[model samples]
Target: MIRDATAFLNRSLAVISGIEVSGLALVFGVLAIFFVLLWLRASGRARLAQRALQTAEADAARLDTVLKVQAEMSGRMQTMAEIIGSRQADLTRALSDRLDGLTTRVGQSILSTTRETKASLSVLAERLAVIDRAQGEIRSLTGEVVKLKDVLANKQTRGAFGEARMQAIIADALPSSVYAFQATLSNGRRPDCLIRMPNGAPGLVVDAKFPLESFTALQQAADGETQAAAATRLRRDMDVHIKAIAEKYLIPGETQDTAFLFVPSETVFAALHEDFDDVVQKAYRLGVVIVSPSLLNLSIQVVQAVLKDARLRASAGRIQAEVRLFGEDLERLDARVTALKGHFAQASRDVDQISVSSDKLQRRGERIAGIEIGEEAGPSEGLKSVAGE
Candidate 1:
């Protein structure tokens, strides 16, 4: 039994050992499988890490290149900004200078315009004042013209007006002494005025009576028949007046051969010249000069000039007499001046001889005083020396 037990024990021990060995082997195999799986995972993880590291390295390189490009762009941007700022500064300065110039020119132009406007306003004001004065004068003149027209409406007033106008013209043109108003002639006819001639002969006679009614009718006629009748009446009236004046004023030795038929109205005179050539010729034949106020004034002025010429001639004769007297007086003055010069020359010679005598007397007196009480001064030698001097 002991032996069998021991062998069984030994067999159990061997089986147990085999089981343990198997378990150990199984553990080792599992460990080895786990190790292998871990190794495989690790290797995969390592490969993923390597791939991630390589992608990270490439991204970092790309980031570095982008950062460098960004830095260069920032520098270029700063430089561009500085250039724009400099250009803006230059543009601002130039615009400011141009605005200053324009402002100065505009100010000067405004000042000049202001001065010109002031001057124009002052001139306009002066012209307005002058116009106001002219307007006032025109008003006064219009009133006077109305009054004059009223006065000229009647025949008597018209005749008086003509006479007064003739008198005024005569008074203005001739001196009071050279003209007479309403003087009775040698034929017992009263002439309106008479102008004294320069030769002291008979004066020129002027008659102021005119046929104004027929002239007025002629002027008022509108129709041809009325105008013709009025013109015929005017010619007849003028012929009668011319005959009357020729018979009344024209005297052989007392008055001029031609008598003036004074027409105060210039219109009437113009109408006579224009339409009544036959009447004018008749008046000329009758020695009646149809004179308007203007013509009469001219005649009076001519008379004045003739008188002035005569007076100048008379004055020239008187001046010649005075000049002859003045020449005689000048001759007398020259003779007196020559005589006075001769007297002055004689007085100078006498003064020179007296000075020489005084010198000779003074020398002789000194010689006598020096001769110690018995002086024998030679008067003949002193007198000879004075004569020689």
Candidate 2:
């Protein structure tokens, strides 16, 4: 179409050149308008091409920068992956080591606790055994207490018990030679014990029998009036026993002025002293002394001390005689020692004189040996030289 339009334009221009001058002016105006339109279209096309080139360059720059940024980001991500893997490995190893330590500590703690629990159980077992043994001993003690209660329940057995206790105390405190059990006095009455005093002093009697029924009743009384009646009966019974012991045991010449009324029970004796003071005074006035087991033991100790003093007094002359003989023997021994010393001194002086004589003889023998004689000298001449030396 553009070629056709160019041909048409060429024909028109030739036509216009041959036409009149008025027609050429009109033709020139139309050519100018077409040229201006062509120029404007060409300018618009150039500007569009420049804009497209600028846009393509900008797109290429943006693509290159995006590629470079993507590559850097990939490197950083790879480095971060390596760091994360290392950190994970380190954390795993650290956690493993800590877990191992914790496991070991827990195992040791469990073992220690087991051992401590075993020790505690063993100690508890031993304590339980000790408690079992103690319980057994308590049972045995309870049985023995019951037996003792039974023994004290009977009056005759109780009386015998009191006598046995009194005898045991006396036998332990006094010698058999100094005391006699159930000895018959001159009046044909037998006393429980007769203690022979020292230095031909009168014998002392001990009566072990005591009344305990009224005292037992007093202890068992339920009311005030009953208690008072029991107390009165106990006082009367005590008075009767005191008088009997005083009358039966006391002898003017053969026995001591005081006789012992032995009350084996300290409780009973204390009761008598506390509640029945008048009875004790009456017995004291009648030459009968009420004695508990402790009092009897003490009295026996005093008697033993008196006997020891009397024995010492009786042996005074013999001890003096023996001392005199010992002194004489000491004097003799001293004199003999003095004589022996004198003999030793004389022998030492004799030995010294003998040593001096032997030294003198040795010197003379050396001088004789040192003397030289001529080979041709006669025997008589040598003898004479020796004698002269």
Candidate 3:
């Protein structure tokens, strides 16, 4: 039994050891399984990690390429900024220069306009002053014209004015010696004036009375019938005055052959020529010369010149006579001077002969006085006779 029990214990011990060994083996197997699973998981994780690492390497390469591209773009951008800055500076300077030139031109234009405005104002003021003065002068002239019209309205006043104006013209044109006022002619008729011509005959008579009333009536007549009547009267009046002047003033050997009918106004003379040509022709046939104031003045000047020439001719005769007398006196004076010169020559010759004779007598007396004769020597008879004489 002891042996069986010992064997049983040994068997138990072996079974226990087997069981523990199995458990240990199972644990080891489980550990191995765990280790295997862990190993598998580790392998899967390692494969995923390897893929991720490959992906990271690719991404790093791409990032490095992008950085290189970015660096190049930044360099280009800096260069473009510098070019833009230079362009802006040039534009600013150009605009500033243009503004300065425009300002100067505007200033000069303003000054020119100011000067032109001032000069135009000055000229306008001067013209205004001149216009004012001319207006005043025109007003004064109007007053004088009114007074002259009033003076011409009356017959007596008009006649007197005409006579006075004629007198003034005649006086201004001729010397007083060549003309006479209100002179009587040989026919016992007094004329307004007479102009002395160069001839010794009676002077030219100038009659100033004219038929002005008839002419004025003719001028003022409106209707044809009134004008015709006035013209007839004017012709009749002019014929009567001309016939009277020709009969009274145109005397042969007493006055000029053509007597002057003086019309003081040129308008009257023009009217006679224009409308009264027949009257003028008739007056010419009667030896009557019509004259206006201007014509009369010129005629008087001609008469003055002719009279002066005549006086000069008369004085020439006296001058010739005086020249002849002066020649005779000069000849007589020459003859008297010749006679006196001849007398002076004869007197000089006589004086020379007397001097020669006196010199000879002095020589003889000296010789007689110088002769040293003895006391007893009697003087010569010639010497004694000379001393006694």
Candidate 4:
């Protein structure tokens, strides 16, 4: 390629006009301008072509080197990928085994927790059953008690029940001396009950029987006429009972002018007033007061007031007795004190006489036992005994 380029240059120099050759050097002195222009243009193009050819050859060599390098790297990359995949498989197996064991343990824990919950539920159920049984027994016992109380409220036994209960209430409310029970009125009929008055005198009397069965039957009657009949019978019975008691027990200025006929049941009192208005009006005219237990309780309060005054009087009597006894004791004490003072004065006079006799005897003894009477002179020498004998 260099030889071909040199031969072309020789031919180009030979064909030029007015050109001279100095050995291998060609000179176009006058045509130097054209030559310079042509050389500039052709040299630049020829240099560019040479550079392009060199660059193409370098590029081809570089491509061959790149292909060989890529082949070697591909083999290395494949071997490394196989090794990494085996390690990953080992790690995955280890993780899977660990997860399986953990899952098994978790399942066992869940089962145990479930079993405990079931056992607790069973115990709760048993406790609930026990509570249910206890509630049932309590309800049954309550029912029986209610039935017993209802039976006592019936007319057959209500009178006795009320009397016993009322007596208990009275006993609890007052002292024994403040009241008395079952006192005989002056009319020779013993009143059903009595209370000591303010002066310890007889108090108002009460009769405690009033039938409720007929009234209850009246209440249970299907028709108004039957109810009216029941009412008539109850009212008539009450009037008869009151009249009998009044005839037997009510005496002028003896039994309390107003007497109480206690209706143990309010139902009977209500029946007389509600259905048999005329009979009640008659009872009022007869001066017989119809009283239920509640009304009688109010009447008893009146008796209690009288009893309070009686208690005060009794207490006054006790005070009077204490004062009398105190006066008697003071009189006896006064006599005893007078005797003590007299005895004390007599004892003092006897003591004065004994003192004088002792002084005389001491002087006589001193004269009989005489010695020199010096600074310690004996008293007998200093005294003149009887006649100086």
Highest TM-score scorer? 2
Writing each residue's lDDT as its tens digit, candidate 2 over 1-389 gives 98875555455343445673343455677789899999999999999989899988998898899889889989988999999999999999999999999999999999999999999999999999999999999999999789768877888887888888889998988889999999999889999899999888999999888887778899999999999999999888888888887778788889999999888789989988998888899988999999998899899999999999999999999999999999999999999999999999999999999999898788778867865767577767766766664
| Residue-by-residue lDDT tens digits, candidate 1, 1-389 | 98875554444232443463344455566899999999999999999999999999999999999999999999999999999999989998988998898899889889999989999999999999999999999999999789779877778888888899999999987789998998888778889998889877779998888878788888899999999999999888888889888888888998989988889889889988998999999999999888998899888888888998999998998999999999999999999999999999999999999999898889777765554433364666555544454
Backbone clashes in model 2, listed as residue pairs = none
The estimated TM-scores of all candidates read 0.52, 0.58, 0.46, 0.41
Q: How many clashes (backbone N, Cα, C below 3 Å) per candidate?
A: 0, 0, 0, 2
Compared with the true structure, model 2 gives a TM-score of: 0.58
lDDT of 4 by residue, 313-358 (tens): 7799899999999999999999999999999999998899999888
The local lDDT score (0 to 100) that residue 168 gets in candidate 3 is 84
Candidate 4 versus truth, CA RMSD in Å, comes to 32.7
RMSD of every candidate to native, in Å, equals 25.7, 24.5, 36.7, 32.7
Local accuracy of candidate 3 as per-residue lDDT tens digits, 1-389: 98875554444222443463334455566799999999999999999999999989988988888888888878877877787778778877787777777777777777887788888888888889889988998998899789768877777777666767777878888878778888887778888888777657678887777877888899999999999999999999999999999888888887888988889789989989998899999999999999998898788777777777888898998999999999999999999999999999999999999999898789778867776767455677656755664
- Regions of model 4 farther than 4 Å from truth: 1-155, 178-188, 266-271, 313-389
* lDDT score for residue 87 of model 1: 90
Off by over 4 Å in 3: 1-145, 318-389
List where candidate 1 sits over 4 angstroms from the true fold.
1-140, 313-317, 336-389
Q: Highest lDDT among the candidates is held by which one?
A: 2
At residue 46, candidate 4 shows an lDDT of 99
Q: Model 2, 342: alpha-carbon shift in Å?
A: 1.3
Against the true structure, candidate 1 reaches a TM-score of 0.52
